[model samples]
Target: MRLIAFGESFVAGVGDPDHLGWVGRALAGRRAVTLYNLGVRGATSTKLASLWRREAEARLSDEEPCRIVFSFGVNDTWHAAGEARVTPAQSLLNARAMLTEAASLCPVLLVGPPPIPDAGRQARIEALNENFKLLCARLQVPFIDVFRPLAADGLWVCEAAAWDGAHPGAAGYQRMADLIAAHPLWRAFTLAE
Candidate 1:
């Protein structure tokens, strides 16, 4: 299996103490699968989507099947301080575009962003995430709601699992990976391989 992941710093494993990103953590023991981490720190969904082709070309071959995992939403909500920032509608559009592009290549697993504490910001993030989920369903692609599970457990806000109350620590990443690995989509891929 050739898996390519694209997202922001969280997907880049910014706060992981072990220094191995989720790709490294997730594909650790697979014998025949090749995992590629295309996560870029501070990459918005729009930017990541734009860069996807360039990055994917280096790892993807014409004959090999591929799977794309997209993680975003937090940056879209958190970085909207100026007029140029993406609105909720535009955020959804960006996600849709990403899904559209990914579908053309292979199966896509859309992983929604983890929850952030600020209620005001979270409202936008939640809207974006919900839209992403709906879009995934519409596209018949797999969707992973990391926000619901992580937020429900209060792991995202816990101090021990984060450095600045946002990004996940190693334990948090482990928990996140566990959640991801257990998802039916991930299990299906793992088992199929």
Candidate 2:
């Protein structure tokens, strides 16, 4: 099986000293799988949507089962000077188009963006996540909401807070790995054929 995961820093496993972000930990030890992590730091949905299909198509092998995982959104909520990098409406369009295209290719899973300590940015992230969840539901793609849970998790918050207030360390990544690993949809996706 080939799994192509697309996202930003969290998908890249940015602050983990171990270098194995949640993607590495969650999918570790799976057999007969080729995993590609296409996590570009500071990538927004527009950036990802523009490039993902071509990249993923090139990597997928017709001889094997394939899966796609999309986890991103936090970057779009970022502010520069005074403007949101990617507006909420633009984010929705990107999410719909990206998830729809990816789902057409294979079984797809959508993981919501994680939380940060900044109240303003966090609020944006939370709202984006809600919109993403609804979009995923409409598209029939499995969606995992990491924002609410991770926001309240002491370990996740402390690790991320003490660091860049965005990325977390190993233990925090491990918590995310656990959450993702335990999700029922994730199990079903991995278990399928």
Model 2 alpha-carbon miss at residue 180, Å: 0.5
Q: Which ten residues in a row have the lowest lDDT in candidate 2?
A: 184-193
lDDT tens readout by residue for model 1, 81-192: 4542566787888888888877887777888888777777677777888998898899888888888888788766583334775676777777788788777888775554
TM-score of 2: 0.97
Give candidate 2 regions above 4 Å deviation. none
For each candidate, the alpha-carbon lDDT, in order, equals 0.77, 0.91
Best candidate, TM-score: 2
Model 1, poorest ten-residue lDDT window?
78-87
lDDT of 1: 0.77
